[model samples]
Target: MTAMLEMRGVSKSFTGVQALRDVNFTVRAGEIHALVGENGAGKSTLMKVLSGVYPHGSYEGAIIFEGEERRFRDINDSEALGIIIIHQELALIPLLSIAENIFLSHPPARLGIIDRDAVYRQTRELLAQVGLREHPDTLITDLGVGKQQLVEIAKALSKRVRLLILDEPTASLNEADSAALLDRLLAFREQGIASILISHKLNEVARVADRITVLRDGRTVDSIDCGAQPVEEDRIIRSMVNRDLAHRFPERHARIGSPVLEVRNWSVYHPLHPERQVIKNVDFQVRRGEVVGIAGLMGAGRTEFAMSLFGRAWGRNITGRIALEGCEVELSSVPAAIDAGLAYVTEDRKQLGVILADDVRKNITLASLAQVAPRWVIDDVAELRAASDYRTRMRIRCSDVYQETGQLSGGNQQKVVLSKWLMTDPQVLILDEPTRGIDVGAKYEIYCIINELAEAGKGVVVISSEMPELLGICDRICVMNDGAFVGEFASGDATQEKIMRAIMHNKRTSNGARESDMPMEGVRP
Candidate 1:
C-alpha cells in the first residue's frame, strides 16, 4: 500500500534550541497514526512544520502528500490541500453559534451575502456525522469541552479534510468523552480520512493507533505497528521518558498538623445566569502540612468552588464564610485574597495561569512585585535572583530565567505557574489540575514538590480529574458532586471504587480527614 504522507530529513531550530532534528515520519492511507513523545520532544514542532505554521524555507525538510512534494507558506495554503490541524486549546469563538463558527471563514453565498439557511442545513449534516445532537444555532459557550471537541471535528469535515491533525484532543476530556472521540477517529479511518494523533494518554494510543511513532529529544526513537504486533504500555513509557518509571508518584512521610484554613456555608451563583446556583452550601477546610484533594466530574463544581473561594474569581452572587487560623477573614477581591495569605492556581493554565509572552523572571515576580520592589519604582536584580532560584529549585528546563514562558514545554510552563503563586508566600495553596497536560515523569516531580510544600507546614488543596493522582498525594480525598461535598476519606481508606461510590451515592461518609487511613505517596493504580 502506498503511504498517505511522508516526511524526509525534517529539522527545525529556535534561537538556542534544536526542537527537531532529521526526523522521519510516515502515515498510511485511512490510518490513525499516533505521535507519542514527552513534552518538548519536538512533537508539536514537527506538526507545525507539516501544517505550515513554520512555513517553507523556515525548516529543512520535505513533506510529501498524495505523492507530490509541496511547500505550504501558511495555514491557509495547507488547508487548501485538505489538511486541517485542531490544536489542544480549541479555536472556537465562545460567543458565536455553532453553525456560524463552523463556516466563519467561508460560507455558501450568492451576491456576496451568506445564505443562513444553507449554512444551517449543511451544519446539521456535519454535526450528525460527529454524533453531536445539539442544534446548529446553539452557542459554543453553551456546550461542554467534549461537545466542543466534536464540533471542531464537524468543522473539519465541512472543509473536506483528508488529513486531520489532533493535538492532545483528549487531554481535557473525561473517560466516556475520550472513548467517544476515539470511536469517531476509528469511524473516520473507515471512511478513508487519515489522521495524525498526538497525546500523552498511552492507553488511548494503544487502543486506537494502527502505528505509533516515538520521538525523544527532537529525534525519532522507534515506531511500533500494532497491526503487526501488540506493544506494552510500560515499553512505550520507557521510550518517551527514556528511563524506568517504576513509580509515578514520589515518597510521602506526612505529619498531619493543625487546621490552617476553613470555609463554612459557601455558596455562589452563576455570573451570567443569576438564578442558577453554581456552588451550593458547601463547607471545606485544609490543615497545616496537609494535602486535601477534591475529586469530581467535569461539571461537578470542583473548579467553581475553588475559584469562588479565591476572591470570588468565578461567580457573581457569592456568599461564603472563610477563616484563616481559626479567625474569619474577608476576601472580596483577588488582591484581598492574596493579602489574606491565600493563593489559587487555576485549572485552565494557558489562559489564566501565566502570561505566555513574558519571561520567567517577570512571571515569577508578578504575583509578588511588592516584595521585590522596595519602593514604588523597580528592582530587576532582586526579581531576577528570585526567578533564577525558582528555576533551579523547580527543575524548569529552560535556557535561562529570561526565557519566555511560551517557548518552554508544558511541564516547564506549569512549573512557572507554580513559581508565580509560590512567590505570593501564601499559607494556603489551591492547585486545580496541577498536572493536567504534564507527562508521567514530570507528574512525579510535581508530586514531590507538593509533598515539599506540605512538609513546610503549608495547607494545600488539590482538584484533579485523575483518581489515582488524588489517592496518591492527598492526605484526605473529598468527593464532590453537584456543587456540594458528598464524602471524605483518609489516604489509607480511600480507593477508586469507594470514592466513585461516594459520588454515585451522593452522601457524606466521613466527618473529616483522618491520618490513620494510608499514605498517598508512592501508591499505584
Candidate 2:
C-alpha cells in the first residue's frame, strides 16, 4: 500500500514547553492507523500539526501527502486537499439541523444562494452511506451521541475526505455505538478511505488498527505493523509510558464501615416533562472507606440520579431523603450541597469540571474560596499556597500554577478537576465517568486517588460505562437499568457477563418499561 500521509521530524512547542519532539508518523492508503499514548505524550499535538491546527511555520515539521510536500497555512488549506479532522469534542452546532451542520461551511450554492434542496439531497446520501437513518432536518441536539458521531463522519464525507483524523471518537460512546462506528470505519477502509484513529481504548485499537504508533514524552517511540505480528497491550503500554504497568488498576483492600451517605425512596422527574419520571424511587447507601461502583449502559439514568442527589441540580420534582452520617441534611441548592459535605464530579469535564480559560490556581481554589479568603477577602498568598499544595498532591503536570487550565493535557486537566472538588473537603464524593478519556497511566493515578479517598474514610461513588473499570477498582458494583438497580455484587463476585446479564434480565422482565409505572413506596431492586 502506498503511504497516504507522512509527518516527519515534527516538533511543536508552547511557550518554551515542547509538546512534540521530532515525531515521525505515517499512514497507508485505505488503512486504519492507531495512535496510542498517555496524555501529554504528543499524540494530539502530532495530529494537530498534520491537520493544520498548528499550521505551517508555527511548528517544525514536514508533511508529505500523496508524494507531495504540503504547506498548509490553515485548516482550510488541509481541508481543500481532502484532509478532515473531527476533534474529541464534536463541533456541530446544536441549534442547526443535521443538513445545515453537514454543509455549514461549503454548502452547495446556486447563483450565490444556498440551495436547500441540494443540501438536503446530499446530506441524505451521506447519511445513508454512514448507515444513519435520520431525516436531514433533524436537529443536532435531538440526536444521540452515537448518531452525532455518524453525523460528523457524514460531514467529513461531504468534503471528499481522503484522510480522516478522529480523536477519541468513541470515548463517550457505549459498546453498541462504538461497535457501530468501528464498523463504519471498516467499511470506509474497503472504499479506500484512510483513517488515523486516536483513542485510549486498547481493545478497540487492537481490533481495527492495521498499524500502531506509540508516542511518549513528546517523541515517537515505536511503530508496530499489525500485519507482520500481533501487538500486545502490555508492549504498547510499556513503550508509551517507558515503564511496565503490571496492573492497570492499583490493588485496594477496602475497610468498609458504617454508612456515611444514605438515600431512601429517591425519585426525580424530568425537568421538561412534568408527567415523566426520570428516576424511580430508589434506596442507596455508601459507607465510610468504601468504593461503590454504579454500572449501567447509556440512558440508564445513572447521571440523573447523581445530579439530583447533588442539591437537585438536574431534575424537577425531586423527592428524596439524604442522610450524612446519620444526620438528615437539606441540600436545597448547590451551596447547601457543598455545605452538607457532598461533591459531584461531572462526566463532561471540559464543560462542568473546570474553567478552561482560568489558571490552574483559580480552578483549584474555585470550589473552596472561603478557605483561602479570610475575612471575606481572598489572600493571594494563602490561595497560592493552597493551589500549589494540590498541584503537587494531585501530581498535576503543568508549566506552573499560573498556567491556563486549557493549556494542560487531558489527564492533567482531570487532576485539576479532582483537586478543585477535593478542596471542598466532602465526606461523600460521586465521580461520574471519572476517567473517561484518560490514558492507562493516568487512569491508574486516578484509581489510586479514589482508593486514597476511600482510605481517608470518605464514601466514594463511581459511575462508569466501562464495566472493566468498575470491576477493577470498586469494592462493590451495582447494576442499574431503566432508572433502578437491578442487581448488586461484591468485587469478588462481579463479572462483566453477570452485570450485563442482570441488566438484560431486568429489561426482559419489564418489557422495556420503566419502574416509574410502579408506586414509589414499595419499589426496590
Candidate 3:
C-alpha cells in the first residue's frame, strides 16, 4: 500500500541542540501507527515539524503526503491539508459550551452571521459519532477530564481531519474511559482515518497499533509490525533505551513497624452538595516503615479521600479524627497539614505539583522555605544546598539545578516533586498516581525512592489505578468503592482480582441500600 504520510532524512535543531538526526518515518492510510520513546527523545519535535510548527525552512526534511511533496509554513497550512495534532496538554476553553468549543475557529454561519442552532446540530452529531453521551449544550468546565478529551476528538473530526495525531491522550483517564477512547480509535480506523498515536502505555500500543516505531536520541531506532510478529514490550524498550532492562519494578524489603498514622471514622461531604458526603465513615492506619496502596476504579473517591486528609484539600464538610504518633492533630488547611508533618504529591504534576516556570532548585525548596531561611529573607545558598542534596538523593538527571523544571522529562519532574515533599520532612507522605506518565526506567528509580522512604521509618500511602503497580511496591492494599473502604489485604494475600471483586461487591451492596444509607464518597484509590 502507498504511504499516506512520509518523511525522509528529516533533521531538526533547537538552540545549538540537535533534536532530530536523519530521521525516517511513514504512516499508512487507515492504520494506527504508534510512536514510542522516552521523554525528550524528539518525538514532539518531529511531530511539530510534520504539523508545520517548525515550518519548512526551519528544518532539514522532506515531507510527502498523499504522493505530493508539501512544505507547510504554519499550523493552519497543515490543517488545510487534513492534518491535525492534539498536544499532550489539551487546548480546550473550559468555560465554553461543547458546541462552541468544537466550532471555535470555524463556526457554522449563514451570511456571516453565527448560526447557533446549526452549530449545536453539527456538534451533537459529531459527539454521537465519537460515542460520547454528553449534550452539546453542556459546559466543558463541568465535564471530567475524560469527557473533555472526547470533546477534543469531536473538535478534530469537525475539521475533517485525515491524519490524527494524539499525544498522551489517555494519560489522565481511568481504565474504563481509556478503553472507550481506544475503541473509538479503532472505529476511526475502520472509517479509513489514519492515526499517529503517541503513548507510553506499551500494552495499549500492542493492542491497537498495527505498526510501532521506536525513537531514541532524536533518531529512528526501528519500526516493526505488531501483527506480523508478536512484538514483546522488552524488544521495544531495548530499542528505545539500547539496554537490557532486568526489572521494571525495583525490589523492596517490607519493614513494617508500629502504627505511625491513624484515621478513625473519617468522613467528608461533597463541596457543591453539602448533604451528599463524598467520603463515608472510613477507618485505616499506616505503620512506620510501610507502604500502603489504595486501589479502586475511577469515581471511587480515592483522590477525594487523600485530598481531604491533606488539610481538607477537596471536601467541604469534613469530619475525621486523625492521630500521628498516638497524638491527635487538627489539619484544617494545607499549611496546617504541612506543619503537622504531612505531605501530599498530587497526580497532575504540571497543574498541581510543580511550578513549571521555576527552576528545580526553587521548586525543591518551595515547600520548606523556613528550613532554608533563618529569618524572613530566603537564603539563596541554603536553598541551593538543600536542592542539591535532593538532586543527588533522587538521582534527578538535568543539565543543572538552575534549569527550569519545565525542560526536564516527565520522570525527572516527578522526582523534583518528590524532592520538594521530602524536604518538608513529613512523617506521612501521600503519593497520588506517582508513576502515571513516566517510563519503566524512571518508574524503577521511583520505586527505589519509595523503598528508601519506608526504610527511613516514614509512613507512605500510595494511590494508583494500575493494579500491577500497587501489587509491586505496596506492603498492603486497601480497596475503596463509592467513597468507602470495603476491604484490605496484605501484599501476599492481595491480587488484582480480589481488589476488583471487593470494589464491585461493595458497590452492588451500596446501590441496593437506601439513599440515606449510602456511604460518603471520599475513599482513597
Cα lDDT over the full model 2:
0.92
Candidates ranked by lDDT = 2, 1, 3
lDDT of each: 0.90, 0.92, 0.90
**Best candidate per TM-score, number?**
2
Query: Which residue segments of model 3 deviate by more than 4 Å?
Result: 507-525
Worst 10 residues of 3 by lDDT: 516-525
lDDT tens per residue, model 2, 183-300: 9999999999999999999999999999999989998898999989998999999998889998989989889998888787799999999899888987788999999999989999
Per-residue lDDT for 139 in model 3? 93
Report the poorest 10 consecutive residues by lDDT, candidate 1: 516-525
Q: Which of the two candidates, 1 or 2, achieves a greater TM-score against the reference?
A: 2
In terms of TM-score, which candidate is stronger, 2 or 3? 2
RMSD of 1: 4.7
Per-model TM against the reference? 0.95, 0.96, 0.94
lDDT of 3 at 296: 91
Writing each residue's lDDT as its tens digit, candidate 1 over 1-525 gives 789899999999998678899999998999999998888999999999999999999999899999999899999998989999999999999999999999999999978999998999999999999999899999999999999999999999999999999999998998889999999999999999999999988888999999999999999998999999887888888998899888777878888787788777789999989999988888877989999999998899999899988888889988867878767788999999999899998888789998999998998889898988997755888888999999989999999998889988898899999999998989999999999987777888899999999999999999999998999899999899999888888999999999889898998786565332323222222
* Better lDDT candidate (1, 3): 1
Of 2 and 3, which scores higher on lDDT? 2
